[model samples]
Each structure stands twice: as structure tokens, then as C-alpha cells.
Target: MSLREIKPGNHGYLYVNSHPTGCRAVVDRMWQQAPEPAGDRPGPVALVIGSSAGYGLAATLVGLRAHRMRGLGIAFESAPTERRTAGAGWYRTARTAELAAEAGSDFTFINGDAFSDSVKEEALDRLAAGFGKVDVLVYSIAAPRRKDPLTGEIHRSAIRPLGTDYRAKTLVFKEGVPQIGELHLPVADEAEREATVQVLGGADWQLWIDALESRGLLADGFRTVALSYVGSDITSPIYRAGTIGAAKQDLEDTARAINTRLKGTGDAYTVVAGAAVTQASTAIPSIALYISMLHRIAGDAWQGTSDQAVALWDQLVGNAELELDDEGRIRLDGWEMDADLQAAVRTAWDRIDTDTLAASADTEWFREQVGQIYGWDVPGVDYEAAVETTVPWPGSPSTDA
Candidate 1:
């Protein structure tokens, strides 16, 4: 099939062939901008969880581009191939490895459930044998649900205000229209909520760090960071203040715990990042509508996923001192979610006419943003080229078949 025939949700295969040249362009820019190692040591090694797509992938790219760090990415999903779609990180790892090879830097990828103990052990073993230790660790995993490895029970999450019924306007991205809906907060028993907390919260993070430390895989002066978002009060009850909020609270608290573990080790610290639209973010109710309205109010052209990732990378690695409020969380989304800004967006959302949504709302730009998440809309390449690819999944032979 031709590249144009490839759909946006069809894994990430189309990215390899759709804009091969543009992909090369980004790789070249990364290589040129990447800093050189000060000494004879191979540059710092970075391990990024959730490094398949969104901010995680951007962090990996930035490590190579901005810091000249060799990286190992751990992703839970399948890798994308020319004939089949793969997860976001899968394609990203493949692409990054391809670029790193050309740039003469080390890049390895592991495909497994990062939350699994076996996977953690394998990853530590690989890092120990290959790089000895990692100088930076980035945790950006965002999963909606997880199976209890011990109990084998499935748990799901909901987006709603805790303890109160709330009504909100939601945007139907495909339809490009606003739909008002009632969101019922989950009334699941405390056991379920606790399970959700255990699965989605900071336990996995703690496990990763503990495993790495036990294996002696963390380098001295290393920095470890995790991403979290506390949306505005409008979303507080459902997100920052709800069950998920509780989970995020645990995550934030875990950061402090991890920080304590890293202290007195010369230069270790933890960071909690601000909000941005990611694949995970788009799945949350009311967020798309919120982002659409915010995009209109900002007036500056909206950026694609790659653009947002680049912005975040610039902030985190290129400029580490992100503007923080008294609370210590980086304030990028705080500025975006400022009361005044949100009020303006709320007004714009209210003003959106139902009949003329195509003209009234920048649906085209939103669609492009969605497309760019899977590497569509990139420039300077023929989407018709046939490109072969491979992922690091075990027993999967590297093939052009």
C-alpha cells in the first residue's frame, strides 16, 4: 500500500516512509546541536521510560541532540514495522537508533512491560553489560490501566470530579463539534481505587530505582526526573484532585522519596514537569476541548507533537532551570492554565458556534497535531518511499521480508 493509504492510527509504521527525508532533517539537526563529551568517557547514558512517544521520545531525542548522551529506551508496546503498525516508542526507538548509528553514538532499545520485574532485571543486565551505568533516568510512563501482575485482575480508570456530579463540554475531534456530557465519577470501592493507585502511581517508579540501585546501575552525579501534570481547578477534581489526582499525589511524593535516596550523592535531584498534549493527555475528557480553546486564545500558531516535545526538551535539558512557582513544580502548564488564560479560553469555548465549527474552530490544526503524533505532516519527503524497519522485541528476526 502507498504511504498516503496509511491511516494515522495504524501504529507508527507510516512515519518511517512518509517523511524519510524530513526524519533525516530532524536527525541532522539533533546531531549538529548535540553537545560533545567533555572528556574521553562515552557520553552519559540515559534510560527513558515511556520513551516510545510524546514527551518520553522527545526526552530521548533531546538527550542525543542536546546533551550528546547515548540512550536506552524501555517501551511496553510493540515496535512499528513497514508492513505493520507499532507503538509510538517502538517507532521512535527505531528511528533514534538509526540516527544514533549514523552519528556514532550508542542507542539500544528494549521492548517489554517496564512494570514487570523480569523486564526490569533484563534492562538492568543490559545496561550493566553495555554502559556500566546511566547518568540520567527519565520516567514518563502514562498508562490508563494495568493488570495486577500478582492477581491478574484488570483495572480501569475514569475521568470525573470526585464526590460530586459534574457536567462539562467535550470536543469530538473527528466531528469537530462540541458535545456537552455528564461525567459520573467512579464509585468503585476503596479496594479498586487503592488498586488503581498501586498500579498507576509510584510503585513502578520505586521498583525501577530500587532495581537500578541494587544492581549498581546508577552513576554518581546522576539526575532522575518524572513527568506529572496538575491541570487547572476546572480539572482538579477529575484529575489533580480525583482518584487519578490521588495517584499523582503518590507519584509526587514518590519523587521526594527517590530524591532522599539520591541525596548526599553529589548532584542527584528529581523534577515534576508541567502539562502538554500527549497521546495520553488527549484521552482525558474535557482536555481536548480545553486545549482547542487554549490554542485559539494563544493566537500563536499551534504546534504539532514534535514541536511540543522539542519545546519541552529545550526546557528540561537545554535550560534546566524551568520557572517554578513556590510549590516547586515547573510552571509551563501553570502559565498556560493561568486563571486569566483559562477564563479567556472558557469564553472562547462558549462562543464557538455549532453550525460553523469548521470555520470557528481550528480543527484542521488540531487534526494536524493528532497526525504529527504518529510522524505525519512532516516536511520534505515523499510519503511513497518503501522503508524497512525492525524493533528489539525478542525472537523477532531483523528482516525486510
Candidate 2:
């Protein structure tokens, strides 16, 4: 295959093509930018579901680079074909392998649908054969739909409000220019609510834990965490008070149930992460607007996914004590939820329109962050250079492929 520069082929929230070289560079920067490990601590074997991009990938990198742990990551990603490139997650995984190798860490990546029973079983077998047991499990799967492995039923998640139509000012692009837009989201019906919970909730996390324990693959002092989100007042109507919130509530409940099942053997907690630009977040109405303004206000102090991951490791394994809320969930969004910051954000929100968007928000930074998600706008990368789209992932071939 001949080398060629790859630009993002989709608009708004999704990217259909990725540049392998640029993706690797982004991963490399994250790995390098991470703080050094605290000490010569014994490495734990970690299993990270949805461990290819976003917070999942960040968690995997934290395990390998910060704690020196061996890891197994399960992510569903596309394989490259003759006419197209694989997703950014594929290239990120490949880069992870290289960094892990340099750090004397080992990671076994599985490319398959994490919701499937077959993939779960394969992970169990791999743990039994290669690592013996897993000390940490990070559940970070984010998908639009999930297929029930036992009943063959499919559930799709929704982003609608719970009881009323939600209207919010959102960030949008018109003819390649950033502007303010509005979103009017309707209420989610009972069926849609249930489906959202089934797809995005902790049902899968519970199953993964149950399977590991049933097979005696959980190591002593085991710990698990599922990523979560709780939007601030700015996005409460469309986010925290919406269908996605219901799913997150279920996730919290599952963590509690999993803790009870652990019964002194291990613990489970839901981690509410800080706001950042991710593919999933992009899909959420007003999130981009909020994040962009937040970035502008917070400047360099804002926590990127990598920063959040390092802080997570500090709480989970390092010396820092876990900052728990009243509900016993870990809080990583303290900075994002600061009172003064919120006030500033709201003030900026009220002032933003297409005419004022450029001056009011960090639209350039916002666009750059979105572009980097698909490996397009990383600094120092030669986008003019030719590159291969058929980059091989350092993992098992996808079953579908």
C-alpha cells in the first residue's frame, strides 16, 4: 500500500478516516507527558474493557505507564480495508503496545465486541492462561447499542430528556466556521429510557465482574471502576436530568451491587470524570459549547483525559487518598465543577452567539481537540507527508473481519 495523508472524512461528532502516524504521535505525547511512576511498586494485571480510545485508552495507559502493570484491553474497532483506514482507536492500541514494550510492560489487546459472551469468555481464558488473575478491572465501554449475549436482544441508548423537551445553546459549525446553535431534545419514553439503561448502565460491568469471579480469575485485593459523568448546571437539563443520567445512575447502582458481591474480597466504585472533548461528548448537545468555554476559562489548568487518568491512578494505587462523595463515588471533576468557574462559564454561555463565539470561546482549541480525536491536528505532525492507512493493530483480528 502506498503512503498518503489522511484527513477526517466525516463531519461534527464522528471521524471515518484516521492518519496512523498522527495517531501514534498523540499517543506518544500522552505517554511521555504522564508523570513518572512513584516507586518500584509491584505491577498489577488489569483488564480494561473499551480500552482503545477516550477514557478507556487513558486508563490503560495509566496502568501500564504509571503503575507498571500488565494489562488486557478489549475494544471493538474496525480493521483497515483497501479503500479506507481503521478507526483511531486501532492506531492508538498499536502505539500503546510500543510504549508498553519500552516500559517492560505487557498488554494483550482483544478486538471484539465487549458486550458479547464469546468475547467475555475469551478474555477469561486469556487471563487464566497468561496472567492467572486480574487485580484491576476498568469498565469504560461507551456505545450507542449493545446486544444481549444471552437473549440475543439489542438495546440502544438515548440522549433525550427524561420528562420534558430540552432546549439548549450548542456549539456548531457552519461552512467550516464555529457558531452557536440550539438543540431541542424531546423527552425519552419508557422504552427508550429502559433501553438506554440497558445499553449504557452497569449491567455489562456486573456481568464482567460476575464472570471473572465465577471463573476464579479475580486476584486478591481486586478493584474495579466504571467511568461516569455528571454534568454541571449548564448541561443539567439535557444531560444530568436526562436519559443518559438514568443510565449513569444505574451504573452507580451496579457498582454498589458489585461491592456487595465482592464481600470484603474487593471493591467497586464509579468515577465521575472531568469534562473534555471526546467522540461521545461531541454527540451530546451543548457539551462542546460548555467544554470550549471551560477550556477558555481554565486555560492550561484544565484536565485532559490523560491528566484525569493520572489523577485516577494516584487515587486508585498511589499515595493520594480517594476523594469520595456522599454517595461513595470517586470525584475527578472537582476542578470542572468549581463555583467560580461555573459562574464564569454561565456568564460566557449567556453571551455566546455566532457573532461572538470566536471572541467568547476557544473555538480554535476546540476544533483542534476535535481534529486530534481522528489524528488530524496534532502539533509537529507533518500532515503533508504520506502515511499508511492499513496500519496493523497490535491485537487479535476482529471476529467480523
Candidate 3:
């Protein structure tokens, strides 16, 4: 199928071939922009759980390219089977291997669910045999559903509010300009809230680390962090104060527990990121509105996955020291909440309607970023040409001519 011709599913999720050039653009920029570290001593061996796209992809890129480190990227990405190709994550993983090879870096991509105990064991086995122990384990897995490897229970995340329904100005992506519309959200019940926490919270992160530690896969001086987010007051009803927020609170609690449990080895952190349109963010209620308003206020400063990854990774490695909040969490949401910027965005947000939305928020940029998540809307890519779906995985036989 032609890349541009591929349509999104009913839920607005599109599956496309990941753009190699666009992926390279992100890495190249990160390589050039990040400060050159002193000494020939490079960073540590890392393992990124959700290591195909978004922050996980960015973290793997930094480890292999910028940090001059070996890494194992484990992601539950499907291979290109039959006529249809796998989603963009698979392509992104393939491209990461290519980039790593060119840079003479040791990198591996494992295709399996990070939430599964069997998959975790496989990763552990690989890490034990190949790298001994990882210095940093970045748990960046974001999934809609998680089947508890032990209990055989399935958990799904919810993004609705707790008490009442939420109605807000939201963006509807279309042919050209995004149409602004009012979206009504439902309220999540107790069961839904618990389910979201189980899937999206830090329990899995803690479990992964515990498994690693029990098997002695985590090296001394090893650190771990699972990404979290806390947006401004505007979207709290659906995000920070919703079912998802409850999960994050659990995640943050797990971070503290890890800190206490693994005193000598290292500490676990819950790094709170900003409100940006992501695969995960799509599930959040009114994300379109929140992200649009944020972009309006913060503009270029709204931290995307790449720069945010760099910042978090820098903190993880102790290269950069940030003043963490009271809960000992790293806050890297960018300038969206800045007083002056907040002041500037209110005028537009207050008067925002279908007509004024185009004028208020950078909907073009918003859509571009959202599309880039699925390997669409990227510049300098020939979408009309056929994209080779299968690519070499690590040291596997070449799928190319």
C-alpha cells in the first residue's frame, strides 16, 4: 500500500512505514545539540523497554549515538508479515539498528511484550550473557492493555475523569485545518480507575526492576525511571486528576519504594513530562485541546519526546542536576506552565471557537507532530514510493538487495 494512502483506523490510529530520514533527523539534531561530554569514558550500558518510538526510541538513539553506549531495546513490535506491514514502531526499530551499525555501536532490538514475565526473562537472559548488567534501565512502556503475566488478568487504561463528565474544546484532525469541536467525556468508575493504575502505573516498573535485581541483571550504580506526566490545571479533570493521575500517583509511590529498597544499587525515579501529543497522550481526554493550548503558550518550548528524553537521560546519568519536586520527581514539562506564557495564551483560549481555533493554536504544528508519531507528515520523505517493509534486525540476514 502507498504510505500516504494508508488510512487511520476508527480510533484515529494510523499504521505507516516509519520514515528513516525523519528518524535520522531527530538523532542528528540530538547528536549536534547535546553538549559534548569530557573524557573518553562514555556513558553506561542501557536497556529501554519500549524501545521503538517516542521517548523510548529517543532514549535508545541517545544511548547508542550521543552517549556512546551499548544498549538493548525491547519493544512489542510486530514484524512485517504477509501483504500488510507492521506498524511504524517496527520500522523505527529497524532504522535504529541501521544507525547504530553506522556509528559502530552495539545495539539490539527484541520483539516481545515488556510486560510479560517470559519476555522479561528473555531480556534478562540476553543482558546476562551479552552485557552482564545494565547501568541504566529506562522503562518507557506505554500500552493500552496489559495482560498480567502471572495472574492472567487483563488491565486496560482509562482517561476519563473521576466525579463528573468533562466537556471541552477539542481538535478534530481532517484533510487540512483541524476542526475545533466540543468533546464530551465520561466519568470513570472505581474499577476503571484501578485498571488504569495497574496498567499505566509503576507496579510494572517496580516488577521489572525487581525481576532484574533478583536475577542480578542490574549492575551496581544502576538507575531506573518510568516516564509520567502532570499537565496544567486546564486538563487536570481528564489527566492529572483522573484515573490516569491515580495510576501516576501509584507510580510515584513505587519510585520511592525502589529508592528505599535498592539503596546501594541505585534509585528509581518517576520523571514527569509535559503535555505533548503522543501515542499515550491520545488516550487522555481533551488532549487535543490541552496540547493546542500548551503549544499556543509555550510555542517551540513545548518539550517533545526527543529533547525531553535527553533531559531525563541526562538526569538519570547525573550529567545534569535538576531540583526535583517534594516527591523527588524530576519535572520536565517545559514552559507551558510559565506565568508569562500562561498569561499570553488565555486571550486565545478564552475566545477560542471553530473559527478562532486556527488563529489561536498552532494546529498545523500539532497535527504534524501527531502524524509524525505514526511516520506520517514528515518532510523530505517520498510517501508515493514503495517503502520496503522488512529491514535487518541486529545481525540478521539482510532483507535488502
Which numbered prediction scores highest in lDDT against the true structure? 2
Clashing pairs for predicted structure model 3, backbone only? none
Order by TM-score, highest first: 2, 3, 1
- lDDT of model number 1: 0.62
Those runs of model 2 whose alpha carbons end farther than 4 Å from true positions after fitting are 12-14, 395-401
User: Candidate 2, which ten residues in sequence have the lowest lDDT sum?
Assistant: 392-401
Clashing pairs in 1: 52-88, 52-89, 80-86
* Per-residue lDDT of model 3, residues 1-401, tens digit only: 22233333333433344454454444455455444445557558888889876677777877776676776889887666545556667767766787778877777878888888888888888888887878988888788889988799999887788899888777776655477778787888999999999998887898888898888877888888788888767778888888888988999999989988998668788878766677777656567766777787675676766677778777877779964888888888756667777666666667888887767777777767767776666777666655555555556676655
lDDT of 1 by residue, 225-287 (tens): 677777666666567766777677787778778778877562322344444556777777766
Q: List TM-score per model, in order.
A: 0.80, 0.96, 0.91
The 10-residue segment of model 3 with minimum total lDDT is 1-10
Clashing pairs in 2: 4-387
User: Residue 221 in model 3: shift from native, Å?
Assistant: 2.1
Which wins on TM-score, candidate 2 or candidate 3?
Answer: 2
Cα distance off (Å), candidate 1, residue 138 = 0.3
What are the lDDT figures for the candidates, one per model? 0.62, 0.87, 0.74
The better-scoring model by TM-score among 1 and 2 is 2
Candidate 3 or 1, higher lDDT: 3
